[model samples]
Target chain A: MQTLNAMPWATNFWLAIAGLLLVTLVAGLWRIWRGPTATDRMLAAQLFGTTGVGILLALSQAMQQVALIDVALVLALLAVIAMVAFVKRMQGPSS
Target chain B: MNLAFDVLLGIALLLCAAGVFYSRDLFRAVVMFIAFGLLLALVWVRLDAPDLALAEAAIGAGLTGVLMIDAVAHLSAKNAHHQGAQFDQTGARPQLWSRILPVFSAVIIFILLLGAIWWRPDAPVSLPDLVAESLPESGVEHPITAVLLNFRSYDTLLEIAVLLVAVVVAMALKPDTSEPEAGNSKDPILHGLSARLVPPMLVVGVYILWAGSYMPGGAFQGGAILAAALVFLKLAGFGIERLADSLLRIGLALGFIVFLTVATSVMIGGRPFLTYPESVAGELIFFIEAMLTFSIGLILFSLFSQAPPPVAPTSSLQGEQDER
Candidate 1:
């Protein structure tokens, strides 16, 4: 039962995660803007999904709740299905 | 000391994210995104969520990477005419203020949220206490297991339904393309690497599934890893057609059917739904999880490979003739 005062590492981890996620936000926005095609934007969205998972994991640690990790898992799984669906759509009907 | 490590990880993550966005070639961008995913998994590990890290690596990084690469290939093939360096220099000249606004807003929101969390360091106690107290009687030692199965079993059930719905929707959207057409080239290096990688991956996936009872690994993580292996095999042109058979269909349905049957039986026994009899609870849980792994693996691989609905008998004859 470590008190808040003793857990400086958790604070540090959150700060680190926030900074990284900010960069991901910037990059993802850039892709959304400069994407020449629909597929590029979709790829960018997938990147955001990956970053979101990372942020969720970091939050789980800071909150000390393992349930948040399950949310992250579900998010990851959903992201994969979304990516595959988009890819198949882009491929179109193969003659 | 903690701040320094945090800053370092943040910087590393930022660099990778930038690489994913700024790369000119679509293929390069996809590869960088995969690298970013791996780094994100590391951050999750650092954040004390090993189960999430596993899922992130297998599904987020591995499966998503494969899908992105496939998309890139498909897109590149369709638009082969516009080939000379796709990144345009002039397009990069956006107004500075326009770029700055979004960044500023994001930072402000982040700060406000962080301040709120820090201000209330003690999360009001009831939920945490409830979870802690109920864990022992839940038939599982891991807190996540307790949360997922005992306290929030209804949510878990709905989550499975959502997964199945997504599969159905995806299937409806994509026209059938299940047969292994001789389209993609075989890279010797990739083939060699996959052969080396897949066996160990299978072993690890199973170990994760069984060890999940005591640790931060589970059916989802294991299934995602197994899906990755199957996807790898498909990408390398191994047994793609065989995967479209009835066996895979049975594997894909096992989890949902077993779970539904057990849950319904509990209701018939005059207890709440999904409540297992005390004597066979552990065995029942393991059975559900094992079936879940197989079902999830097959479903994801089918989704990735876009395996068409199982061939009609006449279509099988056509497929064989086409193969010949």
Candidate 2:
């Protein structure tokens, strides 16, 4: 952590990762838009669950905001909960 | 290059916002909104506001997404008999002029806001510097926490009161039907997830509350996490909320009650309301914050759990079904 803090290259690497994750996030949006099933659309939020974590992790390093890693942990937790709620509610007492 | 990344992020946010507003399917719009929330959390990070980012991730992206998705599912199930127009209907397309007029007015308002920003003068007061100067006496190391709990604790008290009031109203609005117990996750996978996740979430919630003394984490964020954990356990099939009905009610208002007591007790010492003595101020803030965290968690969970049983899939011969 100290070495990364001292090195300019580390910042660049993390920034590059963040940028790539953003691109991936935007790419995943297509699945939500083109969804022929509700599950397909929900995959977009799952995409956010993973790629968003990666983005926060990268930016935490790039921006020197360690607090964001906690945010990422939280985002991961909540996103999965959201998915669970979706599945449970969608069952609608029939399943 | 940093500027390029920021601009790209801004564009992505705009795209998600547009997707949310324009999506034809209600489910699609809700998904778009969740995506928008993820982007908004990133934007908060970019703005150097980690506290806001944490709150947004917990409440906006996660909880709101679940609530909206729940509502959408309920809507579909409630109107299950109505074919072709249940989830897709935006209630008839608006007249061209009605849509155009709103957009036109929005553009005009946007330009006026831009002009205001362009002409606004620099403030004479530097609030952050003032906060920093008073930091040592404020009892907490984090400026935001210090300000929120010490210099302006009355506002935090009121915020807790507001949360209490919101939950009270939700309780009132809850249908009179005997509430069915949630947290019966018959799914084995959900069972596994809850067992593993809930403990860590509780630890993280307390850790966040502790971190508020020196970092971005605070009662609201920690409380939200605690609530999420309860929500998780409920979803995982635990039946925890029902098991402790009386305790849950007390937990919902305990924070406000404690806060008001502390605020008034200081009057015996000749201090104004909410002014903690400098000697024990830090300990006092932490005590209040811990209670607030628990109360907040319960309050938020009640809001989610008490929602009108999702209008239930009634009207069939199965109208007797209690669970949504």
Candidate 3:
């Protein structure tokens, strides 16, 4: 079998996977919208963060656009900043 | 397959936007807004603009999400403290016309954008070609970097000025009275994670900055990543307050100063401002990007620090001892 990178069919195959990832993100958005607490909303957003990275990586591989990988890397690493901000806010003096 | 993916992305974006707008809870709205930004980054990738994707992810989603979440928390705290006074002074529901006006304007802007897209000229002149044709002379292998730092360096100069002004204004705001309490005794998890996380993030941040010349990563993304790491460290009880007075000040201004000097000095050779000599253009742009990275990081740090959030005090050393 031809390596995925060399095959023309890979783009379509990977794009379908990206579509599925998009569906997962939409489900996460539902959780954000229906949140019973701020933590729930934040956790849903965190889920989107990881899923977004996944979508980018899949596309990066399919399109062979290596730059998308850098974007993915940065997203994965910095994604926690918002969560840190949230927890800190919750634990602030007033809270 | 591509068409289906595009359709899904569009629907997801619309749903996220609606979630941000219609959510009654402000905290949920802010979180939805962040999810919206992440979706927009994905859209940028699909649009074949990885540079925009990077900016959207790092600055648009990551930094802005942090800022807005902090704002939400701060506002709630303030409201709790001044509940009666707040209700008496500003509790009136906005006038109908006042609320309607923004939505009206937003609709108008949306129509105008749609019209612009509809009216796009067939076989439109390729700006990409124009940029590509002159990229080698501009001193960078990446078109966006070349345009940003050399070809249209003035735009970048002004952008840096905008960031600088934002930092200045943020500084002028009354400092938060509550210092982020030191020691993470309440949450040892975050304290341990920060130790393992920050050093590698710093390395990745530097790598992104250095890769900008021929890659999608650039000073803006690099600086934002570094800034995020700093925010994480501060949250975990590491004191960065000492650097704020001196080194941070220098880093905040370094990019603008270096770019301004380079732009004007080139004019001494009887050339237009910011026109680099082809032989040294690459080296010069790299230097400028380096300064820009440092400055961008410092400015973002100041943005977060001026309104420093409270840190959870949990000493990892204590945790280790407890385990032993």
Candidate 4:
């Protein structure tokens, strides 16, 4: 494992990007928390899905680990399933 | 910089956890729980446990969120007429005294955990060392895969058995009456999106399954992805209702059946149960993992696909006897 003194900029740069994306994620969480409607909360959760992918991508790059990228891919692709389930639930059985 | 990142991540995790429990609406709480799962995945990454990170992101955040939202929807539908008491029994605010024990217990547990971590010797004997030593013979390059499938195969076998029992329990709970009719949509956009999405999902699931031999990916992650793909197809209005029940039943049991057969058959060599002969270890493990992927996928999909049993269609004794 490389120390903080060596290759400092690369790790810090990627981490900085991750930190900013996390801020966006927290903001999305705020919307989810304060939601007056289930749909609004679901949409904000979707934002969490996308922002999570971004954070994973940055961390993977920073760590120079390709496996981390696979986590991002799984999150990105399967993220839609939750949304689809939400939409179906919203439509109710009559739909 | 690293410390700063850790601090922010810790704060985000705490906030998400709080939001999940404190939110008044069950739906909002479920949504916040998904966010918490995602942030927990990030924490796993920071701690250098990529396997857990992947599992948490896929199963915890993705599929679990789907399941919870589905559950909440069913619940709200049942209680729709009673909406005036929105915070009914399940969501009722706890009494003040009710909160004290839980908080105190949580604090005690947290302190114990911290003490355990801090008390560890500088160079503790590690299980990884044993796993690594035996890994060459385990027919897998990944330590986790080796440990799971070979070194401690019993645990993995029992884990699969637990999944089997869960699916069984779910099946037993299913309503006796015939399933409700499908509500197929005629939306062309949904059709178009489903067509574009499913192929890639299948490919990715298979890739994850195959990569498990040498990497962080494995059957659980792959199976969850495959299950998600099925869920997506169903949600897009695919008429999978016609799929034969026998076929699904076979798929559900295939993993355990195959794994058990292979494990016992290997005992014919008089080595031990689940101990692969060195010559065919890789082939045996790959085949077992492949079967497990499909079975796991089918089980999880069925759990999500079936609705919670509706009030059993009011049936008279005569009608039940006639069906029997």
Q: Which candidate leads the pack in TM-score?
A: 2
Query: Per-prediction count of colliding residue pairs?
Result: 0, 3, 7, 0
For model 3, residues A1-95, the per-residue Cα lDDT tens digits are: 01235466888888988889999999998888776656677899999999998999999877778888888988988898888877776544333
What digit string (tens of lDDT, one per residue) describes model 4 on residues B1-324?
Answer: 778888999999999887876665677788899888999999999998888888888786557988887676666555554544342247557887776777788899999999999996777677778888988898988888888888888898889999888888877777766555445654566678889888988898899989889988888888888888887777777866346778878898899999899889989989889889987887888899999999998888888766552222111211222332
Better of 1 and 4 by lDDT: 4
lDDT of 2 at B144: 93
Give candidate 3 misplaced runs (Cα > 4 Å). A1-6, A92-95, B83-108, B123-125, B175-187, B308-324
Clashing pairs in 1: none
Fnat by candidate, in order = 0.02, 0.52, 0.69, 0.61
Candidate 2 C-alpha error for residue A95, in Å: 5.7
**What TM value does model 1 have?**
0.68
Instruction: Encode model 2's per-residue lDDT on B189-287: one tens digit a residue.
Output: 888888888888898889989998998889999999988888877777676666465777788989888889999999899999998999999999999
Worst 10 residues of 4 chain B by lDDT: B312-321
Best-matching candidate per lDDT? 2
How does residue B311 of candidate 3 score in lDDT? Answer: 36
Candidate 2 docking classification = medium
**Candidate 4 residue-wise lDDT, A2-78, digit = tens:** 21232658888999999999989989978887765666778898999999999999998777777888899988988
Worst 10 residues of 1 chain B by lDDT: B312-321
